[model samples]
Target: MDAIDLASLLCSRLCHDLLSPVGALNNGIELLADEQDPDMRERCMELLSESARASANKLKFFRLAFGAGGGFGDEIDTREARTALEGLYGADKRIDLGWMVTDEKMAKGAVKLLLNLGMIAGDALVRGGRLDVGAEQRDGALEMVIRAEGPRILLDPKLREVIAQGHSGGEVEPRAAGAWLAHSLASQAGGSIQLNDPADEVLLIGVTLPN
Candidate 1:
């Protein structure tokens, strides 16, 4: 597929994710306007605030992981990427985050791969779990590892296939957008991405990027 096609797929994925929060925001606004009861109005306001926060967090993450992120820099601060992940997953308070990335900086593409991989792993924790993300730079290369542990984890079969083999041979879908994006970035950089297996207790996503 060409750049436009890939972009379209990613956009579709983003829209799918944001639709819920945006719809909730709209619904909350409508309810607030029609409600006369103080308690009901207060609940609507809370819903609006929550929807707004969720929308903002997802936007921030997509900007960094897929957009220009308001810069032309080749490298971005690792902390910025971690904060984006925190906003995306940790803010919900369902998934506990364990950040072990000690590096001060990383290539922008590398950071995108890291973020997308972490997002995928964290999402696999179907029931609420712990996600540990770690990265290190050594000998002119960067290594990233993400582990998700929980009572139950389910990585979709299609996503696992895309992550393990790539989408070169099959049609890319919106649900596989993140995995495809990560694989594309890694391929461009001559790096590697290791996917998860159904037998494993903890889902692991590993990557290595040249420096």
Candidate 2:
């Protein structure tokens, strides 16, 4: 994909993800303005707070995953990526997170790839589940893994195709932006991605990027 098309797709994906929380924020504001009951107003305040938090978390995540976030640096603090993921996925408590990254910092490309994979895996847990993420720099390469296990996993075939392979034959869709980003980053770095076939209750993604 060309730069312009890729950017547009990423932007579309970001807007779609943020629409719900942002719309909630607007609704909360409108409700708070008209409500006379103190209790109802208090509840509105809570809704606004939650919506704002969600919006922030999603922006932070997309910033790092799809934009030039983490400032000017070859490596980014792993803590930032962890916080972004936890903030985005841990808010609802729908999916439990198990983090086992051993590196303090990793290449920015690696970090982006890792976050995108985590997001995709987490979304596959249709019935709520566990998301385990790990990364290590060894043997002169950065190796990362994201595993999702739940009662019912539903990974879209299009996403699977984009994640395992690039947009080789057809136009790229906005929903596949994240997957495309992951695949592109890996390929650009002379790396590779491995995706396990969809099974009863698990999805596994592994990436290796040479340093």
Q: How close is every model to the real structure, measured as TM-score?
A: 0.95, 0.97
Model 2: lDDT equals: 0.91
Backbone clash tally (model 1) = 0
Stretches of model 2 off by over 4 angstroms after superposition? 70-72
Top lDDT prediction, candidate number: 2
For model 2, residues 1-211, the per-residue Cα lDDT tens digits are 6878889999999999999999999999999989999999999999999999999999999988998984739888999999999998999999999999999988898889999999999989989999999999889888898999998999999999999888887888888999999999999999999988776467999998888
**Highest TM-score model number:** 2
Clashes (N, CA, C under 3 Å) per candidate: 0, 0
TM-score for model 1?
0.95
Candidate 2 lDDT at 3 equals 75
lDDT of 1 by residue, 1-211 (tens): 8778779888998999899999999999999889999999999999999999999999988888878667739888988898889999988899999999987888788888988888888889989899999999878888889999999999998888878677866688887888888888988989998866689888988888887
User: Global lDDT of each model?
Assistant: 0.87, 0.91
lDDT of 1 at 116: 87
